[model samples]
Target: MPRFLREYFNRNGVGLGSVMLGLVLFWTIGLIILPQLSMLDFSFRPNLPPPEIGGPKDLYTLENYKYLIFGPEGGSQDYNAVDLKVFYRTLIAAVLVTLFNLMLCYPIAYYLAQTNGNHIRILALMLIIPYWINEILRAFALRIIFGESGVLNNLLVGAGVFDTPFDFIRNDIALYAGLGYAYILLMIFPIYNVIESLDRNQIEAARDMGASWTRIHRRVVIPYAKPGISSGCTMVFMLSAGALAAPQILGGPSSLWFTQLIYQQFNDNSDWPQGAAYAVVLLVTCILLVLALMRVFKVNMGDIGK
Candidate 1:
């Protein structure tokens, strides 16, 4: 058997490995590498007309990115500045949402993982249930519940809480609420998975040493679950940062999210080069944030799954 395997490897291994390597290279080059180069290429030559299907190449310039990062003078349209603002706002919103999720999810995950009962299962199921619905449908439903004439306001008005309906959509509050609702389940599952695998004896030992609940959590539980918390937060932040539909439907006119700006460039304005540049900026920012979190937490990415 060993001799046969050795012979097969000597003949076919190199060929099979090369084929697999080529396939991977093809996808990497086409999807990620080449597109990034193209974005950089296009960003330099913003105002020039796109090349014909098979026509002369346009000269490269830095006007597009410059216009994006800085406003045009003489009241020229500064879509670039607008795009940059959206990018910054999106990053800030995502970070805040991630922090909120981390604070809320940690205790819940810890409790759920430590406890065992039908009630716990039911609660977990309830949290998981919302994710089963389409995200757009969920966001729309939230909008209805929070809209001026929505049920909450109607109830408040009926109770003489206020004479007029309250505005709940298109504001920063609504945006955060929408993002929180959409991604809370994602935040919970990972933390719960990690906490559930923890050694019960270690917790018990902490308690035996006369440690308070807060102390035990701070010293033992949290340290043990750090990987899970890091993983969950990173996942939620990345998802929320790129989220468009929820913010759009629930955020209203006042809350102009960054993803909307990207969409406008690609779809509304038909400025694919500018849109690609914005996307690249967003991608790089997210990568940096993840790296920062990993460094600060001293988290080994491989431990997230465990």
Candidate 2:
């Protein structure tokens, strides 16, 4: 048996451990893997009318994925520039959101993990209270705040910060803000969980050894928190990139997210194969990102699993 399996059985006893592992296996295969496999299979098949699903026309092909580059029109265009641009922008925004949350959450996570009193409770309550509301509602609330006649614009005008309301919506500012806020907790909790287990004596020793705060965090804290940090990055990037409601509520005229394109393929175009292909592309990209992060941080699957 694997060492982790051995540890699990030792900790939980064989019966409970077996049950736990079995449940996990069932959930992974049933909920996650099976759905992905279905989608993958669908992605390779041609889009056909309901009656033609199992007919001779419903053959497997790479034409669906090819449309991502050549487009639905296909054959004439140099490339599907519009969809490619949206995909690029979405990825860039996701990366920015991940970095933004990482920076914003690290200090708070550090404070929460290290603090030893009622302060932790108070801080945690403050963070959790806002998130208790539905995510869509939270996004709509931001849309309200950033609207032309919104509170932020009114306050800015009143304070003479700007002569007119800034176009936060059209400028994609609201989308960025919404995505960042939506995934902040994902970043915070992971870092906090890992950092909380770190020995304070190591920090004290670093301080005693005359390591500056920046050096201490760079050399000690961040290294130790790699697993959590990697996990948080993975979650934030994937969630932000795949977000539907937040993008819809907060995106402006010019903000074209890649997920919206996939949504359009499915709903508006009614092209299931095309949509599945797009989803597969996105899923593959996210998986590649996970692999890259693991490589960059020297983090193994075992570390994240822990």
Candidate 3:
């Protein structure tokens, strides 16, 4: 670590390296560690009211965590079934959204990276323009579009695809689509950056050797883009899991995200400890998923940083 820092200083100059190092340390400690420590503390402690009448006393206990697995009263076989289902759905939906983005973005990223034209700027702007609006607004836009009487259904009906409007927003499809659209840039940019740096000669050579396009991508391009793919997948999964607004706005009655339960704990139930516990569980889940992906992809922290 010391040798790496010394090299960084020699390469980037002492003053700049010192500033960058300090910023990174500050960000890690201030933004990550301290807030998590605070949440951990909150998670362990019981939620207590003011010391007025007969209110619950403030004390550290594992009850909050237990309540998540067991029933609300604890030690029951029948768990918080709704909460458990929502949590499961949230994780599954996040993974699905990540896969969707990978499938949707990979071809586009490849095309964009390989192409050299003025239309690239226009296409990039089209992606960026939607995001220039607020995220909540974008989610609402999707809601409007997917609603029963909205533009999509109207188009389908008008084009004789259906006799009546289909309810897209009332299903999980809209939720996953919204989540994928929400993080499109994150998936595309990382993959594009890596693929753009790959030597075109390798692809040409493979083509010249009568290799199929799939073979070229699978053997040459994918291996080269593994780090970027891993990083993008990690980021998209984390963001999808942690996202609050899109799920709330775009989800139907059947789609209950775990984050919504956490929000209810904090706001509606006024149970800060339980909320903190839920948040901690989510954080741990995301971290574990990241580690698992790293192992599966043979990627390291250094590759993710790049």
- Model 2 C-alpha lDDT per residue in residues 1-306, reported as the tens digit of each score: 889879989999999989988999999999999999999998999989999899999889999898888776635678988888899889988999999989999999999999899978999999999988999999999999999999999999999999999989999999999999999899999999999999999999999999999999999999999888988888899999999998899999877899999999999999988999999999899789779978977899887755
**Candidate 3 lDDT (Cα, whole model)?**
0.89
lDDT of 1 at 190: 86
lDDT of 1: 0.82
Off by over 4 Å in 3: 1-20, 52-57, 74-77
* Candidate lDDT (C-alpha), each: 0.82, 0.92, 0.89
Of candidate 2, the 10-residue stretch with the lowest lDDT total is: 69-78
TM-score of 1: 0.83
Clash count, one per candidate? 4, 0, 0
Q: Which candidate order results from sorting by TM-score in descending order? A: 2, 3, 1
Tell me the tens digit of each residue's lDDT in model 3 across 51-89: 622345666789889888886773456787777888888
| Candidate 1 lowest-lDDT run of ten | 46-55
lDDT digits (tens) for residues 172-248 of candidate 1? 66678889888887788889998999999999999999999999999999998888888899889999998988888
Between 1 and 2, whose TM-score is larger?
Answer: 2
Task: List clashing residue pairs in candidate 3.
Answer: none
As a whole number from 0 to 100, the lDDT of residue 103 in candidate 2 is 93
Against the true structure, what is each candidate's TM-score?
A: 0.83, 0.92, 0.92
